[model samples]
Target: MPSNDIAPAINETQPSFNLDDYKIIVEGSTSILTPKSEADVFYNPVQQFNRDLSVTCIKAWANLYLNPKQEGKEDIEEPELKKIKIEEKEYIKKFTILEALSATGLRAIRYSKEIPNISKIVANDLLPAAVDTIKRNIEYNKASTNVIPNLANCNAVMYTKEFDCIDLDPYGTVAPFIDAAIQSIKNGGLLLVTCTDLQVLAGQTYPEKCFALYGGSNLMGHDATHESALRLVLGLIKTTAAKYGKYVEPLLSLSIDFYVRVFVRVHNKPIKVKDNMSEQMIGYMCHDCDSIVNQYLGKREERTSKKGKPYIKYGLSKAPTSSTECKVCKSGVQHLVGPMYGGAIHNKDFIKEVLRINKEEHEDNIYKTRKRIEGMLTLAYNELPDTPFYFSPSKLSSILKISVPSLKYIVAGLGSLGYECSLSHAQPSVLKTNADWNTIWYVMKEYVRMKEPNYKVEKLNENATGYRIMTNEDIKLNDSTKSISFEPNDMSYKIEKLRKLKMVRYQENPTRNWGPKAKPN
Candidate 1:
């Protein structure tokens, strides 16, 4: 409803014109007027005309269809077509796609025309008139002549094909069609879905109401609402897939201004599929504060000793101790549901393969495609390494033979690079204060030794607590004020040099309130 200055002006000759509410123009001597609410010209005019006269709509449609890339056009047709072409080449010959809720079929028409060797595409819709229009569009475009058209509601369409890829762009949340959509996909198949009800998904408006429609949890605060909606959708998909002996691996998920789109890969292998649904129950989240606790229902047994008596415990029959208390009303526990899906987006090899295919086929735009593929692959790869704080920082420092303060800097650096890490105080002071020191130190040392042979280290002191390793003088911390200052001597210069190499970081004790005092790196 926000004013769009670029939309075409209405045809003045037509007396019932409302420029603000509709867009009208002439295509090959035929009047093509579309109501603002209904962007598709095919569906708006079909009911008014009989089958014999409906051909008029098709004739007018041709000009708009083929010339979408004309000067100053605001339509989605051409861009979507280009994207399909890119995806097709990247996926290769075995790809199977289903437009689960096709209305007038413009998207399907564009896909068939643009993508080459797209093995199969099923265009479906619930209405008879829409189906008829789709058929007409297919014939008019002369696209994949073999494209199949199905007449069924979105849910029923899922029963027709076990597709390798499925696209769901319903008018609203697409919630009603999700279970069936998951069932329709083969293992490793791609699922692309769109949720257009921004108000509901974004959580600016009512939350419980949104949950009723979307069948998942809602978040209330900042931009997290969008992420919450995406996670909710992913959780629903995972739940549905689990019922049919499958698990969904999220490939790419994003939330734009007014929509949430997710691309996930389904896995149906016996091992990946959980035979006991109970085993899949992973955790419960506090609806009020977003606090999460772990639970396992899988068939794992353990023996426990209480007051000198040992007893065997069976699988996840009861809940574990609450991980966190509700931050809101400070009362009643939130509900638990789902063996929700979790993991990185794409496999590194799969992404590499996609990039190679794009490089060979789309030689002109290979750089652009490679960049996108690399970004996605990097994000997926980065998300998979368990959060940094999962390992004791002090223990990590011991393994890497680095000071705890230096380890903190490494942890903070990794965090700034978009890694997920947490700090814990449950372990000993030496073990608890370090970051992911071992991994960071190894990677840094490998890179540095390969790049700079001049840098060397010597052990100064060794004890039960920890050991001090000194590097050559000539390096310094980039942000000295944030780090501890060594005696401003050769040892200090060496420490600073190590900091520059990202081999260590300065850390401060969280419990000690020393009035913002700097710690050594």
Candidate 2:
């Protein structure tokens, strides 16, 4: 395919195929040559937010390590090995990126035009048409110098070369490419992954298939199954990297609309791989009660020897088995949902840094979804202190047949009880907190029993999961309850602060029938 092989001018034979080319300006910098239709090559307008976020994240990542200052560091010499000292602030100028599945080369071109420190980007695709479209798009955008369009398989190309950054945004599960991606990245590289197979990861239809691909069980019963999906993918990456004496440190992991995206920093450290054991855990979830207990498959404890050397003891050699019955519900058997990455999904400093860049460097209008980014990042930052799994107040209300409480009330009430609480960025109605299911239920029950005296309690014991663990302990409502109040652990004034920044809570459909897009026709 020639660099100028753009679709022929609108004609009877060509039928346009929605091939009308247009320019899209993002972040006040990159101007992408994009097509209107997907009949020839793939392009999703809705995922502009994903692409926009990626640009900022990559820039921040590069600025931190690539363009860093040396402070009192001495070069060490190894007797058995040759020591190579990185020159001060020289290698940081030219960074290489690999976009494994560059359908139309939009992302690659944008990186070239937008990211100042980027030197080269290899945009690859297996489809001949996609390869041709990428080349033409690159030519149209005049990004030929930086983005090299390739006609090759993503995995094959990834396995052959190493890069400072590798992006895997496949149409479905990234399982097949994960190993190759792990091999493709250098010792201290960034890997951004996107998985669109939400049905397999979050849906309950195919447990066996999910296990086969992710080497972990899916939590069909858990309301936050989307989060489990992210963790499952991370677990796969960590396990694959560990096989090569490498480990993954997730900087940011999120469940955006219809898919999951994660940014991870990979490092080569066999000794630190033991940290993954504590980071990986199996979730014991009760189908009846929605109670979740995380049991680590691997355990690590620090010990001191007689010579005063500190060492870690690992106790996880085998896979964990499922429990016969739920610890909370007792009647229902607990479903084993993991062997997934149970570590912190997002790095606070990293996300904060991204937020800072998004605000300080980029303009407000061109980025478009900047406010929502702030809201979401705020929620993510606040939830950092809470546990992994969060309970949905609306789901709990439905189970108990009570009026759904406002998100503010639930959070404030939890805080009053000395428990931390925050809204989940994944789902607006969901609440992430350190309170156990019992305490949550007790609080809700007390609120309901006080407000609606007519509602019967005798019937709840049989149908409501809350009743199974609900105690008669009286929760003294403080004077703060008299007025409608709102407070988040992140110390934000109220949920309104986030909700007021509308359009950030959830993205509006950019077009009709928008979702996991179809392959190029």
Best by TM-score: 2
lDDT of 1 by residue, 240-332 (tens): 777777777665554433466666667765555543343333445554323334454554344667677765444545656654443222325
Which regions of candidate 2 are displaced past 4 Å? Answer: 1-38, 69-91, 305-310, 317-323, 459-503
Predicted structure 2: clash tally = 1
Q: Rate the local accuracy (lDDT) of all candidates.
A: 0.45, 0.73
Model 1, residue 21: displacement in angstroms?
19
With a 3 Å backbone cut-off (N, CA, C), the pairs that clash in candidate 2 are 372-504
- For every candidate in turn, the CA RMSD to the true structure comes to 18.5, 6.8
Q: Count of backbone clashes for each model?
A: 14, 1
lDDT of 2 at 255: 86
Deviation of model 2 at 315, angstroms = 2.2
Q: Using lDDT, give the best candidate's number.
A: 2
